[model samples]
Target chain A: MKLSEDEIRRITLTAINEMGDDATPELVKKAVSRAVSKLDTQPDFSKSTSSNQGRLILTSFGLNQTGVVAKITTELSECGCDLQDISQKLMDDFYTLIVIVDISGSSKNMSEIQEKMNKIAEALKIKIYLQHEEIFRQMHRI
Target chain B: MPFEFEEILETIKMTEIEHFDIRTVTMGISLRDCVDRNIEVTKQKMYDKILKYGSNHVKYAQEVEKRYGISIANKRISITPLSIPLDAFKWEDFVEVAKTLDKAAAEIGIDYLAGYSALVQKGFTNGELELLKSIPYTLSETKRICSSVNVASTKAGINIDAINLVAEAIKKTAEMTKDQDSIGCAKFVCFANAVEDNPFVAGAFHGISEPEVVLNVGISGPGVVLDAIKAAGSCDMNHLADVIKRTVFKITRAGELLGRKVAEQHGIPFGIVDVSLAPTPAEGDSIGDILMAMGLADIGGPGTTAALALLNDSVKKAGLMASTNVGGMSGAFIPVSEDQGMIRAVENGSLCIEKLEAMTCVCSVGLDMIAVPGDTTAATIAGVIADEAAIGIINDKTTAVRIIPAYGKKVGDSVDYGGLLGKAPIMSVRNINCSTFMGRGGRFPAPTRSLTN
Candidate 1:
């Protein structure tokens, strides 16, 4: 399905923020274009993600507040989320963030990781959602 | 924003770093090639050879040190130990030879002279034994010359037979120069395969294989690097590594520039640039002080080994990056008595031979500036030198020993060498006598069997 300009802006901002780039319109556009181009030629990268760990692609939204998206990082660490990579974007308001966490072999199950993340979002009142690294790759297609 | 040079530049404004220029550029010349039959002709040939090759050194070093704003300390020369046995006429023949060397050095404006040596290891030759017997008088009579004798080597073992001989030499030399009130020990050195092109003395002796005339540059800038490390205080591993690499890069540049200029002007082979932290008799500039400032208050303590190892690595890496001709004992020196920090530690009973051995594990060279009891047997000294050489062979690094068995000097007493060599506190040695082990003349091949890699 063809996405609207607003939907592309939101996705691009979140992806740029996830890639630890500035959350400006220009940075988001650049990161989105680069990531999309890379996703086309790259293989499935299935084995790149270690077997004992769970992966998450973190992205920042364009609808967020003026403050930084620090809580997700804090909550992830608290829940024993071993961060493998990070991407982020910052703007006037509504920052976007994307991060990959490895929960491989952790005693705390997926529910615990999500529960802490939910509490952080409710407390700080910032939006956060997750997708597997593979689906994120597909959605990030050019 | 760029780095704020506010603090460092301000300190630079306050301190006068270029206080004294290098007083001497001593080109260590070897006499191994000058050996031949006929005593008078050989003596004449030795003088001709030294004057012919080394005359240009003083003129060139003075010009270069002037150009660079660094003072050319001294323009001097060190020859291979004359091995008096080469001239078997009498003790007087050895003394005359010293005079001839003095004349040759003076002719070149090289006031400081060394290489008046006696190799009495294993056993002295007929002429060597007599010449070694008469070195103190020979040294006292000479005008401006320094000397050394390698009474011990890993291959030759130790010549315990020369203990009483050297003891007599020291006392007489001290007595002969006592009226003149000059430091006599500065004229002599104890060696363990002494390095070629070493700019330091009286330990500076030309190795046999060197080109008759060559320029070796001993680059020293410990204060510079120590300041850099302290600036990166308490950083993580990566940051610490960065600070070390940057500081080394700068100092090595200074050494290479000065060393090359001296070689070219003198029209000699630029032998090697030794990037060693050669400590002077200065108060705060000592290598030991740098280590102590790094958290080991006394150099022989627990943190000592790690500190020395870091120092050695940083110096070599920086020098290697700075120039291609990296040679000599390009490591940190741990000479006691020479550095103020070492003397203080030894006097307070905080440093000893065992701790020095451990420091050797981290720093460069073996037990240096060690002062043993006067009554120490020849065999004991040889044993000590062997143990040090073993460390060098096993680790595949160049190490040396320059011990002083001060005559009539007991442990706990301090012997003063005044300037440069500084003053030494009497350090006692373990009473164990390993003469039997040292007497066995053979090579202990590198410890290859122990290495898993």
Candidate 2:
């Protein structure tokens, strides 16, 4: 966290007040550093962590066809999405695919990625869903 | 993989096939500051305030839905109960204010906007009386404004005079909107022990204690629970409850997460997640079916109340454990028109109003979406509301009456409103005369439950 000039001035004044009669550059530096470190260590439990993260789970399913995985992975690679995990299964002649990707590196945001996937789904006559991974963790884990 | 394969598939199945979804995300906007000496100015302020706070409600909710891959069924708005802020307005001005609310709702593209309400659980103020007198005209005139009045509570007891006046209002609303099968009555709710943070509409209001604006959510997934209970097979009640709890716990967690995300998008405070098993009219999404899966032959069966009680308890327990902000009416909702199985039971002669009343004693709401003969007297309607209120005040729970007297309709005829309103088969109400008792109305004294402190 970067402190603005006003915040730094306020912190300096507070540190000087604490250092009182022993006012010295070294002691003031120590006090200010301690306060900044303390501010960095305490967690803000009120802020929702999921909204800031860019990891998501992608699920796609459709009839068995060639190049289905290739088409999807090709799009993700082009968008700079880092695929962390991939799982696939062929059940009753239908292909079910699940992939976990970190999209913070991608050029596209969640809505943009979903819009692209929707187009691919429509072209291939398949169904695709891209959801933030926080939902899965919240529902399935403690 | 960080998640088990089955876990991912389970959530997809719940949303894609099991009819699991967030029932509503309601933004509560306070209109208290919109009061003015000029009626037109009051209406304009109310309209402007609603738009300022709620214009982006639907858009923000849709973004969250896409982000989470779960659908939000309805995006609605609730405001400070109109009667409170506009207490000095006459009956005609009240109707004008309601029309302004209806316009605001339509402009924001919401299906319903709640909080046209008053709380006269003990006695009425002059403003409340005028508001009550305006309800019929308001309901008949407005297309999207939903109204509710709390005429009883555990601490304040039942206001028999208010109940009587509300009954007459219901009759007038029904007759005035009879062209649409008394659909106006569907937009009104009369409550005993009405909750402040309820997200469900026709009964939701931004209470006086609430902040300037907040976001509250109501979750629905009776289909998911029904499927879980069926998979449990022929087990003891203990194992059966375990199945229900496990299912509800996951759903409640998801519900809270969705609610928080929606509130975050709005840059507002996240309120409570009402863990209600609200059902839709679609097949397989019926609370009645869940009861049957819990070993009842049908809803309104001998063990129906027991089944509902167990289900309601499990919902509350799991919801409480899942979220610290669990509130509203956190239990099972068994509206007749909204649940296919309940509609089937009523149509098959297996369910009656009396049985439904007994069942409401164990559920979140009372006598929801039931239709009666067009000729049902106002005294009879008052009797029904009073009975529901008595149950609520005595038990210290929330119960409501949203009954419709479908005009020119009787015991075998049904009113069909497509979409979420669904359909209601007119059921026979007892013709027993209750005016003699209704005539002697003053106030039902607060019960012993009020002395808990």
Candidate 3:
């Protein structure tokens, strides 16, 4: 539970409620729970248990283990990150991990987590960057 | 009054409409260098390339999508024609590349990969011959890598010898992937004339004449067309034709204007606007649905060919009338997996290759996304290619085949192309072999000229 469970429920319900006026609280609660469950089941985020989600990918310097991709995915997941969609490929030895992750649930200090992830990158010897998902999607638009 | 007629024409031209937007921005990448002398290295190379290029496309396309209101339906990619690279390496290496492509695509948001291809039309390039030999392995190794053998092309003419090879390869590829779920690989396209800038899968690859990297959008909206057609009703066929023409004209205009805007926003010259009514899994927007709405209960049933022909003619008439910007095959696509209505008909034993071939007389890309048995021969595949090409030549239209022979699939099986193309039960091919005719290796004379000297 990144934010308080109550707050999480409130925000999700608000979104679902706003989507349609007749949207039931039960339906909103259920959809948000399901979405959270999906996020929880993600490969990297599955093991994480953080009350305050805090992280930002500062830069991604090509993939090294899957190449460097695991580090990026793990660092974000550890801080409660959710990937919306990703379309990446391998080119020679330098692995590139281009992805669009939704970090909206993280209510903790985002800059702190970003610095922490940068430190993690420094430790793991990988490059990671922090950019919005909207930017990521636009870059790939055809 | 005559001057008023011109004003009305201008007003009609100014009547702009917008519907659905582009979904995926698919970027095709060549996986050739990824192949290595060692099978393991080749596999590794294959895996590595998909992850790299796929991510690049996602990152770039999203930026463009926000600028233009057109939402990319899918973020996708295609690869280079694989036979040359595979022949330069080994057949098994093709499998490695397929695996790489599949995994890489999985990592990125890209749903499909094109360019698992072989060119057999102008006799077999050494790479193509090797590719023909490796169909089963290639089919079995990768989940997403689509395969297509060019059995006939306008520039290369028809190579009956290679066509024979394709029929054999079709069977082998079908068998290899049967257990893995019939793959979404677009396997074969018969082309009377092939364009260089197509952006659809199972068939999209950068031809030699392609720019460094071009952007093209395949705007699909059969739902919009069908709604308009339904409003028009069943009348004398010619009357319906006029209605269809007007509707297609409007639809093409919408696609062209959007395509141009998106290209401009991206700082890339807008290539061609493919005004094809590509169907999806949705109920309202299928080409098959439109056909049935035209009075045929079954897609490949009795009047299917006639309906398809009219649809084709009217779409072209309207599309040509709408925009000078049309480039790709600008007609309806008849892929079984993409249209739910099509899948239902096939599952009910209502459609067959015979009827589908008949319909190919009018389709933009000939015989797209067809799945066949594993034992089908490349020669038979070649025969199928030639049959489709014959229609295109006679009509002087661009037709392509993106056939996927499920490696181990048999008649009456099924596959899901996922996303926009959707899923469909596998339709069976007529159990006929064509080795003899394909063995006759020569070009059919070009179609008769239309203009008088």
Worst 10 residues of 3 chain B by lDDT: B1-10
| Residue B305 lDDT (model 3) | 86
Q: Per-residue lDDT tens digits of candidate 1, residues B56-174?
A: 77766755553343555557787876764255557777788778888888888876777677666557677777677667777777766777666555455445455445645655565
lDDT scores in order = 0.63, 0.91, 0.62
Error of model 2, residue B450, in angstroms: 9.0
Q: Which regions in candidate 2 have their CA more than 4 angstroms from the true location?
A: A1-53, B450-453
TM-score of the first chain alone, every candidate: 0.51, 0.64, 0.46
Tens-place lDDT digits, model 2, residues B99-166 = 98999999989878999999999998888999999999999999999999999999999999999999
- Model 2 reproduces what portion of true contacts? 0.64
Q: TM-score-based ranking, best first?
A: 2, 1, 3
Candidate 1 Cα errors over 4 Å, as ranges: A1-142, B1-15, B18-24, B28-38, B84-92, B117-137, B140-144, B148-187, B433-453
**Tens-digit lDDT track of model 3 for A81-126:** 6765544445675543445555667544444455666786788677
TM-score to true structure, per model: 0.64, 0.91, 0.63
Q: What is the interface RMSD of each candidate, in Å?
A: 27.3, 4.6, 19.6
Docking class of 3: incorrect
Quote the positional error of residue B408 for candidate 2 in Å: 0.7
